[model samples]
Target chain A: MYNDIIIENFSDPQHVGDLESADIELEVGNSVCGDRIRVQILLDDNKISNALFRAWGCATSVATANIFCDSLLNQSLDSVCQRDVEYKQQMLGELSPSQHHCMDILNELHQLLSEQRVAEDVANG
Target chain B: MDRQQLAGYFDYNATTPVSPAVAEAMTATLGQFANASSNHAEAIRNRNAMQQARVSVAEMLGTSADKVFFTSGGSEANNWAIKGRLFNHLNKPGHIITTAIEHPSVLETVRYFEKQFGFKVSYLKPQSNGAISISDFMAALQEDTQLVSMMYANNETGVIQPISEVAKITSARGIKLHVDGVQLVGKRAIDVEACDIDYLSFSAHKFYGPKGVGGLYIKENNSLSPLIHGGGQELGLRSGTENLLAISGLAKAAEEAKCAIAQWDQHAQACKHLMVDLIQQADISVEFNGDTTYANALSNTLNMAIKGVRGEALAVLMDKKHGFIISIGSACSNNKQKTLSAVLLAMGLDEERIQSSIRVSFGQYTTTADIENFVTALNQCVKQLSAMSFAS
Candidate 1:
């Protein structure tokens, strides 16, 4: 009951691994069932230079991790931090009703990424 | 190309497809809409289906036809058996003994009485092998215990409990015993009279019969308060117009299952061994969960944990990309406000085993080729998942 994007990404995920010498590493895990995603990104001049992810959960959750990391490449911290509902809608990408629970995992990942601003602010300060 | 398009069906414990004979029986009664409750000739003809169902179910359980009472399905039967007897003690709340691994129908029903009606419930836990200890049951018994509710076999792990041993104790103490026999009815022959079961519930859909029709076996002399208040039907216990078509299907299915129990057991056991051999030959490390031996559990079910693989993801990949159908646990595994399985949890399994666990259950329709395809797909899926998994 998954969409084409999920099937493709889950089968051959491009950004599924750990990034070496990364500037930001954050994780989001479901408290109940332990579906988790960890994203590591490298920054150049406060802009994302490379992004990769490691995920453990359902296929959609893993695919969404890769999809989320893919969207952050070559992006600035402010732009990533200022993500809105549109970003979530784009990442969800037509999941079925049974697979829709991963939307909450996406939101949690997005929230954790946004909260990286606090760490960035401290570094800048 | 959507490669995963229902290639193999291994989740028989969830529900069985209607057998050809059952389907034909149901189809024959589709247009005959005479209510079994009526007193006319057509109605009497329709009532024969239910009568036939009662006889077959009685033969399966080794009881008389008069002891079987039809209901909508196992859930209603469970509700009636538990609440019907306990409802009689509305003025006086007593004790109940059940297992922590019971189906939700029994667990939640006991929990509701504990919460709303002030009944004291002792939820006995299962040991590591997924079977409840006989000593634990004995310890849980209280002087004022009015009833004991337990399942004949677990739906997820297929762990069979010591019902006969418990029945002997309960019989001597005069404590009512209600066994949820939904999963065990078709797989094993049950003699409710020999075991002295006070009440038992069963379902049709679990054994190639049409869904939405099941029954409860009440001992000949036992009395239970009516769960439904309507015209007298099911001997004034469960009051509703009989589902004639589903009843016919149930009777036919039960008849076939009764005759084929030994053959099905051997077939399912062979398939289970084939799967185990395939898993053993694979390069990956794995651990089989639960007590899977036929002496302790049903041979048709196998719960296992593949190292570092998430079961839900594995199930999704297997179902969506690999054309295999399995489950992380039972259909209601995440129910009862618990995301993980209460059965495994009650058995004291650690979180990792529970997280990585997937259940593959087969039945009369399964074959060795299906098992081979499933294992090959499972190996590929595990490789794909492990390569991408953060923890693995």
Candidate 2:
């Protein structure tokens, strides 16, 4: 039920594993479906120097996590957090209705990043 | 090598490749285009050929030709047997008993009866070893139970059910018994009379026969309301012009299978042994899904779970990289739902094991070298996937 890009990315996820000194690290999972994703990002001058992810689930979810991490490299944290539904749809081209939830991993990761940034701003103030 | 030829097929339970004899028979029968129901001499020839095929199929089941009724395939046969009987008794409210691991055809048909006709149903769960306990079946029986449907052999785990013993109880209770014999007929010896089965369903493609044709065996003095009500064919039980070519193919395959049953069993058992030896030699941590000893299972089927590897990903890797074809579950069940096999869940397996499990079934054509290659590829794929999972 996956496209060629999803299959290729799932088979060999280019941006996987955790960055030891990541500025922001978060893990999210769906308890009902038993899929888990952990995203780690290292920031340099308000830009993502490197982004990595680890996933455990079906092919679609894992591939989407990989694609999500790959797409965030060298992008500003502001731009990454600003990515909307259309951006996710473009990243995952032509997904089936059932697989649309796979993109939730990315959304959860973004929310966690935004929360982390907000906490850092409050501490600085 | 191309994917088609390079892939070692371990999915015989899904479907078998048509044998040379079956292909030849079908090719020869295709020349005769006359309708079997026509009054012309050519049509009479076709009718006689169909009757001959019927006798061959009946002989394979150790039943009489007159007792057999051809249908589209096992699915239709199952639908017809379950729904036809329930429809026949529409005026009388009754109960039905079936196991949880039945094919969708029987399960859906029974569900339809329950919803549409108000027929109560008792779904019997399998023991941990994937066998339905006779005590459980006995306990589930009720005075109003009109029919009991169970598969002779499970399609996923290949665990053979106690159909004969169940038949004894159901027959004594005057309850009609329907056995989905699709997986059992050609692989093992079946004596419908000895087992006292009231109705049995089997398909041709499961046993090296052509697809699109199968049969249902109904005991004498028992009847079902016709599922299809036109042309009055199949003794007014299944109404359609007979698939003469495929029926001829089915007959030839049945005849060949009956003659080669012993050899086939031996070949399959040898292949299974080879696979087990290879797995052990490779030092792969694995667990067999069901009864691994083959005592109550078909010799050709081996369902197993490799530790720390996702079965779906492993299956894709094996197919795409190494050209080894296996299945995570029944072909019909895959991709339909995100959940694992219902058969495994009913057997009390955990979600991890169910998700990691893959079924590898071989047939007469499967050789020791084929098993060796499949194990080699499996070992490599599992190693890669396990490493990937661990790294993640």
Candidate 3:
């Protein structure tokens, strides 16, 4: 349930707020739901050196976004973006339908990063 | 507040805590757990108890005991009454009339019938005051109009409908009238005889009973088909063994609601006064979305839009910091995070105001002190959120 997610992350989290200048960013949440978050990525070579986030939503949504960003850093961007569904699986402890949308920021990030790679390859060609 | 911790519970329109008196009565009935339809003496005792309960509920509605048919909840009653009748009359495709601001049970039922059963439903938009006009209802009625389903009082705004006039118009046309009286059953006085309604649905939870029990009042003169059929319980209109515990709770709850009608009104008024005082003290740009002076609305219910803040965000802030748990709309759909309420939109409220709306419904358990604390917390929260929105 969304309530459980809010309870788990209400007190402490590894990351919060935005990265000042980042190589990649992923935005999620719809205007209809009134919760929006952006996951920012800082790259070292092809690996994600740091990941931070800014979440504008309920406590559960904000907490989940911050937790997601904290778990993604230090991994290769490809693994976090394309090859990882484990990030959400790990942060949630178990999947709940109500809190499922909280993972959308990661989904959006992966799609955007994949697009960025495609754009880079086209530019090189 | 801890989820288990009790606070000043005011959201009665959403649901009420089962009253202690009702709970005891329900427990006592559990000893006779035999099925009501069997031929044995135990079954006969159970059947008698069920009939006695039916009479109690029917008396409250000013109808005969034979008219009452129990169901799981208001949604099933509404769905069964509407679709059941419409499908039974499938030989002639007919138009159905209803208000724009009905609950999801009614609105969604109409939509379902349209998609699957090939029926047409004409939804009449309520006035700015949240009451449907008789003139518009009469104009919408056609020769083939089979049913007109309107709620006695809206769950969102607590605005009562012009049901008497609507019933008269439909009755004169020989049209079946179905009312979703889930909100009006215990809060207000209802006389099905006077209204001439053929079908009505109400739930026990709205009046402080167990959640699963509800009833549908079908006039004996009206011929209707069963939505559920199997073991032939509920005279074959519905099936499966009866939920005796829940039904007993429902009967007891109805009895308490009847006896405490005076106290209910008094508490409702006090809660309304507290809400009015808070609104006046705040003095921010706000508006009550429904009619203030009309008799159609529940005195304890208030739906207001706090000028510049999103209703859901304020609701979240209240729950997080102040330990208050007000709602943006019906709790069932609150998770969907829809910005505008379909009911508010039907009332023709502007998009911005609709986005800022919240519903504060009072209950039997509320106190003046809770309202005072709520006002203080709300003023601070709204001021802070408004300032933050502007700064960003």
What CAPRI-style quality would you assign to candidate 2? acceptable
TM-score of candidate 1 to 2 decimals:
0.91
Error of 2 at B79 (Å): 1.3
Docking model 1 quality class: acceptable
lDDT of 2 by residue, B1-392 (tens): 13345247889999998887888889998889999999999999999999999999999999899999988899999998898788777899698999999999999999999999899999999998889999999999888999999999998889999898999998888889999999988999889999999999999999999888898999963567888999999887788888898899999999998899888988988888889999999998889978866579998898888777768777877877776778884211222346668899899888888888899998977878788888888888777666545353
Writing each residue's lDDT as its tens digit, candidate 1 over B1-392 gives: 12233237889889988888889888988998999989899998878767877898889889999998888899999998899989988799999999998989899999999999999999999999988899999999998999999999999899999999999999999999999999999987778999999999999999999899988999953569888878878777777778888888888888998899889989988999999999889876788777888798888899888888888788878887767888784211221223677888888888878878898888887878788898999999999899887655
Residue pair clashes in candidate 1: none
Candidate 3 or 2, higher TM-score: 2
Candidate 2, clashing residue pairs? none
Q: Of 2 and 3, which scores higher on DockQ?
A: 2
What fraction of the reference interface contacts is present in each model, in order?
A: 0.40, 0.08, 0.16
TM-score of chain B of each: 0.95, 0.96, 0.94
Q: What is the lDDT of residue A104 in candidate 1?
A: 75
TM-score pick, better of 1 and 3 = 1
Q: For every candidate, what is the interface RMSD in angstroms?
A: 3.9, 4.9, 5.0
The positional error of residue B299 in candidate 2, measured at the CA in angstroms, is 1.3
- Model 1 bad stretches (over 4 Å): A1-7, A21-24, A30-32, A42-49, A74-79, A94-125, B1-7, B329-338
- What's the distance in Å from true for residue A116, model 2? 3.2
In order, what is each prediction's RMSD in angstroms?
3.3, 2.7, 5.1
What lDDT does candidate 2 reach at residue B262?
A: 81
DockQ winner between 1 and 3, please give it. Answer: 1
